[model samples]
Target: MGKLYVVGIGPGSIENMTIRAMGAIKNSQIIIGYTKYIDIIKSLIENKKVFSTGMRGELDRCRQALQLSRNNVVSIVSTGDSGIYGMAGLILELKKDEQVEVIPGITASSAAGSVVGAPLMHDNCNISLSDLMTPYELIKKRVELAASGDFVISFYNPKSHGRPYYLKECMGIVKKYRGGSTPVAVVKNALREGQEFQIFTMDSFEEDKVDMMSIVIVGNSNSYLKEGRFITPRGYKLMD
Candidate 1:
């Protein structure tokens, strides 16, 4: 039987992509992924059989990749770590008997964390505001709980044109527990061209600056900003 490798290419940059992921793609007979994601590594996949799918076609894409893998090695690509809101879970769930391997890559949270400093150096949680699979209320509850626990947060799939209200709703819940002065980092297109980010207090956060391509990082109560870098201390008393 042929092998199917689910590879995460990190934050759309050649530098951020893992060597293992690139190796899998180079070894595979075919490369498959969302068109946007495939575009990120277009220069690398040159001359390879590439299958590009559109938005909301994840199942179809994975099915195609899996079917093709029955005879030829296939690399199914996703942005960021494949298991984190990527194709690894669906590919595994749909695999009946096909040989599959998941290649880990840098997640958006980690990329965003690095860009904004060390907001996630300690305990943190990730939540996606997109309700396509999960309900908005459930996401809200999670945000509220995370806030109450004083956990640093990394938000993925935070906002899009269709559901702009979700970001506001989630942030409102967070504000109830974390004051308006809480440090937050808004990052878009991490490690990719057109990358942009800004540090803000929770009250000063601008939802208008966010989009589907953005990741938002919120620091816990103990987190603070120094020289424009947002940081959350990991109980290191020596630093004090």
Candidate 2:
């Protein structure tokens, strides 16, 4: 039987993609992904049979990929690490006995961390503020627990036109545990074209600056800013 490869393209940049991800795409006769992710690797997928769908079509995309993989080498692409909020889980869930290979790549949290500094050097957790698949109440609970535990937090799908206030609400829960001066980094389009980021404190964060393409990192109580870098120290003792 043929094989199905679920590949993470990595922040929509060729350089950021792992060799195995590229190889998986090159080895496949067909490629599948969300429309924007497909456009990101258009150069590498030239002349291949391509399938794409817009947002909210994830199930359809995975179904199509599975069907195609029965007869040909097919690759389904996700923008970041396949296992983290990517298509890998859905693909695996839908397949019964298909040969599947998952290729990992740089996730947005780490990519965003690199541009800002080592904000994820210590204990951290990623929570998606999007309420499509998850309930807002549960998300709020996760944020509260992560914040209370002093875990550096990275939020994905932080804000959107329809869900403009979700991030603000979550930040409110965070404030109960973290101080107003905690560092926050909003990294947009990390490692991609038109990339930009800004650092702000919990009290001064501009909600308008965040969107779906951005990753918002809120520092723990111990996290701080130094020399324009957002850093979360790993509790290492320093020798004087």
Give the per-residue lDDT of model 1 (tens digit) for 131-188. Answer: 8999888998899999999999999999887897888888888888887788999999
* Poorest lDDT segment (10 consecutive residues) of candidate 2: 172-181
- Model 2's TM-score against the true structure: 0.98
* lDDT for residue 57 in candidate 2, whole number 0-100: 95
Give a tens-digit lDDT track for model 2, residues 1-240. Answer: 889999999988999999999999999999999899999999999999999999899999999999999989999999989999999999999998889999999999999999999999999999999889999999999999999999999999999888889999999899899888899999999999989999999999998999898999999998999999998999899899
| Candidate 1: Cα lDDT at 177 | 81
lDDT of 2 at 169: 92
The C-alpha TM-scores of every prediction are 0.97, 0.98
Poorest stretch of ten by lDDT in candidate 1: 231-240
User: Which numbered prediction scores highest in TM-score against the true structure?
Assistant: 2
Q: Evaluated with lDDT, which candidate comes out highest? A: 2
Model 2 lDDT, residue 129, Cα: 94
